[model samples]
Target: MSVAVDCSSEETADILVESQNSSLLENETEDIEEFFNVAMELAKNAGKVVRSAFSEKKNINTKLTGQDLVTETDQAVEKMLISSLKERFPTHSFIGEESVSAGKKCELTDNPTWIIDPIDGTNNFVHGNPCIAISIGLAVKKELLIGIVYNPIQERLYSAKKGQGAYCNNEEVTVSGQTELENALIYSEFGAHRDPEKLEIKFGNMYNIIMNGHGIRAQGSAALDMCGIACGEADAYVEYGIHVWDIAAGILIACEAGGIIMDPDTGGKVDLMSRRILCASSRSLANQLKNQVTPQSFPSD
Candidate 1:
């Protein structure tokens, strides 16, 4: 989490000076690029921390539920990330998973904020899997301006700025063109919420997807799953009990890659902190997945 960005205050001042131009949209774009550069720097540093910790003996513990585990690497990486970012952008708000797990509440406002998941797939990392990533996102004025998801183990980096195209390993990427659920590859990250009724609904959704979709992947990392969809590696993703820091970066990356982040309930807006998500390579596939697994059709609302 000690990624280095040699940007000085003078550069930031220059960016501010440029952002005060006549066109608001252009100014916003410049701001997004500026913050995106910072986020990418932090993400790369976090990736280094994660990779270094992968083979070491980590102190693991549970949170909220036994299924929800946290490692010392998670804590250390988050601390390093927040401290590094604070050194660069002292006024920016930070909402990190480790901080929230340590009893701090995270509330997003219309200010420049950084939402970070130091090690997105802690379980996978614990289990010696390489599907983990460092997720970092910047939101300005309540709008997501930059998204960065870096899988250090796989050496894959996915990033996007608002109104800019998404990229994977420096190459532009897009969502899969598959529009039908029957021909799509779907991924789901089941959180630690294991209520009986919810489990029933989740299993039902899995069954339907298994029967209809070409394949289904159960990954422990929501950010990497979203990157999969962004690069057309996976056609869709559906998960519940996810938090803002979990999918904030992924949402921007997916949307920029032509994927759809849909609300199963109203088929309208998808809130970043909604705790529910159904993403697809296309709107049609997203709607189709929503029809199959929306909670309203089951016991819970």
Candidate 2:
């Protein structure tokens, strides 16, 4: 269950190999192993807190809009995570969705930071659906380095470390190798809040997929949707109006699992904070999906 990768330069290969071999039996020197262990533990603990408050009557507040919600459990779990992480790494930055909503601008710093969504898919949680999850990710200088998404309902854990493969419940996972759109099952989200004209264009693109591809699904949870793609449960997922915390962890896992992600609007590599996303098993399918939806046709108004 432990892996050692040589990312050193040719000149340093001898030293790196010696270091690797020497540390093979040691515990503290392995950053990936340490990160995986801590993340998995913290996520499971947070999941326990979330589950405890799931069915009970708790204070829920709307933020940004009525559709966006936060519950007492979110704050409680975030506080729990922050306290635990701070205890372990006091100098590291921390950003949580609820913490930011409270006016804490925890910017990504050069120092290691933890980006957390204590309970993603809060709307689903409020409605008693079990699709919600706890998303925890570690980023260094704004680049995702480690990710862990835990669904307490299913007791499933999806995790990844940069340059190391992704895993679901300790089993290595990879995106489907489906290269053609016609053989791929895609997942997407469609809603009424978006511009009608823009929606029409997206719908048209989706219609093409429905007719030509294997099928389409809208799972309602962005984190789960990406994880589904990461584990090859689905071939691709595209959506808009999602924030960094919603997709940050899942995106890293998807990419580490061999999936490709791009901005749906520009067909460029996705910025982690970008609101729009198009994730697919292969570059060709992603481009095929992108070509079907033209940004020019989408109204700017």
Candidate 3:
């Protein structure tokens, strides 16, 4: 499908091209536009740093538990981004995963804040896998307003603004219109560290889909998985245990791409910091999946 976008303003054009969201942000102040431009530039710069680190020796470390990992690249990129953003917008808040892991609480104030994951999918990066990203999201008054997710290896940049459409690589894209489970290609994340009972229920849901002739993928990056759905490459993506940074930008992209996002546990609109999520191309599919998965209960770990 073809999407029309105004390429008059360079900044708007760049965002439109990178995002493929058809709708342009209306009446944005020059300051907001400048901030977005800086964010996009910083995110791309961080991607370069990550690529350089990937090509050489990386100092890998563990976080949270043995299952979670971090790298020197993650910290360095975040520091660079935070510093640059602070230099430009000193009054703005910065919330970064690495910084948060270092025991810095990211409290949202009235000022604008940038939510960043300098190198998301550090596990993939550490393992020399290509499914990692740099996620940058902007929020004012704790409300998410703009977001950008870039995968350096793939050179795919997804972005969106509040009330505007989503985009990928300058093409206007939308979620697939597949309404049935049998026709859907779903993406999910499952790992060894997850609770066994939860795994069982998740497996049961997988089994139901398998019986319906649906396809399932377990790409490591949550940001990319949601982007995949946004670009209509995947019909849905669901994750039970994830943090806000993982899905923040992705949720905006998906919504602007005309997809539905919700908390899988409560079947409600997703809060910015929600831990569990169910995202689908359409509300019908989301409700169907939620219903099928709801009857099964998993023990909390």
Clashes of 2: 0
- State each model's CA lDDT, in order: 0.78, 0.75, 0.74
Residue 17, candidate 1: alpha-carbon lDDT:
17
With a 3 Å backbone cut-off (N, CA, C), the pairs that clash in candidate 1 are: none
Q: Please rank every candidate by lDDT, starting with the best.
A: 1, 2, 3
How much is 174 displaced in model 3, in angstroms?
Answer: 1.2
- Candidate that beats the other on TM-score, 2 or 3, i.e. the better one: 3
Q: Which 10-residue window of candidate 2 scores lowest in summed lDDT?
A: 1-10
**Local accuracy of candidate 1 as per-residue lDDT tens digits, 82-130:** 8988998888998999998898878777678899998888888988899
lDDT of 2 by residue, 1-301 (tens): 0111112233222212212343332454376567668888999989888888888887888886676788889889999998898897788888788988899884665577788899988888888889889999886645567889999987889998766788999999988867788889999776324566767766887787798789999766788898998899999888766667778789878877878777777776565554677888877888887766545232110
Whole-model lDDT, model 3: 0.74
Candidate 1 accuracy as lDDT: 0.78
lDDT of 1 at 163: 58
Give the TM-score comparing model 1 with the true structure, all chains together: 0.88
Candidate 3 lDDT by residue in tens digits, 208-271: 6666637888878888898999899989887766667787778778777877776676666454
- Model 3, position 212, has a per-residue lDDT of 61
